[model samples]
Target: MPTLKLAIADDHELFRKGFISMLSNVPDFEFVLEAANGQELLDKMPGHQPDIVLMDLQMPVMDGMQATEVLFEQYPTIKVIVVSMYDEDRFIIHMLEKGVHGYLLKDTTPDEVEKAIRRVADEGFYYSDFVSRVMHRKMVNRLPANKHPFFPNATNVGLSNREQEVLQLLCDGLSTSEISDKLFISSRTVEGHRLRILEKTGTKNTAAAVAYAYKNHLI
Candidate 1:
């Protein structure tokens, strides 16, 4: 497998160093650079183009939110995974709106951190359980009166009930294995459903499919 280059941007020197040390042990990850703040990360970006960035939300200069915006705006191919201590819905939703590939807590385990990096690199998103729950709750709470949260455009689009169930779980940020477990189906079946949903919605990926559903007010 190809190694993924990584960058870390946090204001805390000790935390940064410890993260770097932990990541260095992961076989598939290559630590390319480190930054004390968002501006520093940006300044180093031109010189070292990492495939993924582990960003901290709060910093002295530029901050993670601004840095994430600028990074994606300037280099759309690079992926960003926001690793912060904040678990508030606003922070999670704000980063999601900014198009981050993943959201992780600061207290995340080394295994989950590695998993998040690999998942985001491969699957285009890695929403921890907390992040997914928060997003689902917010979206459900914001639904208009007398409209089904899972099928806003059910009549307009001929999505089957099973597909809607799959899509809703996807929007909740459940991985394929998790979805399969929850639905009592095989992972391959879940993947087939995912592909069909993408095809039906004319989307290129899971993220785009979810975006289409939300854009058309499906979920």
Candidate 2:
């Protein structure tokens, strides 16, 4: 079986090592890079090409929030799952805003960590039940912001029926191939719809696209 390259960014050495050790025996999992902080993570990522990253928020050199924004702009292909101790509503809401594929508490189970890795790897997102419930409540209570001319017309965005279908499936966390199988369409066709949805909604990645769908009540 092909290996899945993984990386972790954390300031705590003991925790970093322990986290890696916990998953050391998982099949097909390989650690290609490790970083003490977010800046270090960015510095090491270019040559390593990890498929996914387990990020921590409170790093010394550069925090996860900054790194996440940079990663979103720089490495759109690399998925990130924030594994932090903080579960404050603001922290959770902001991470989702920054486009992480998943979020997990640092105290979560190794099984959950492994499962989250596999889920994000296969589905492009894995918002566990906890995160889902928190996000839904927060989004519901969010106050309406001033409308700005710079924002894409998310509410007014028009999508073909097929594109709408694809967006809904994406919001459901179905990856390209999964959507292909479910919809009986080619992967390339699914990708095409994915791109058009991003363009129409002004989102850069699937995570952001799903966020857009939620923020705009699209799905």
Q: Model 2, 157-210: lDDT tens per residue?
A: 888889989988776666788899999999999989988998998776676677
Q: Provide the clash count, candidate 2.
A: 0
Clashing pairs in 1: none
Clashes of 1: 0
Tell me which residue pairs clash in candidate 2: none
Tens-place lDDT digits, model 1, residues 107-184: 999999998998888767787778767766765675563465555474457777889899888887788888999999
What is the lDDT, from 0 to 100, of the residue 11 in candidate 2? 94
Q: What's the true lDDT of residue 21 in model 2?
A: 87
Overall local distance difference test of candidate 1: 0.82
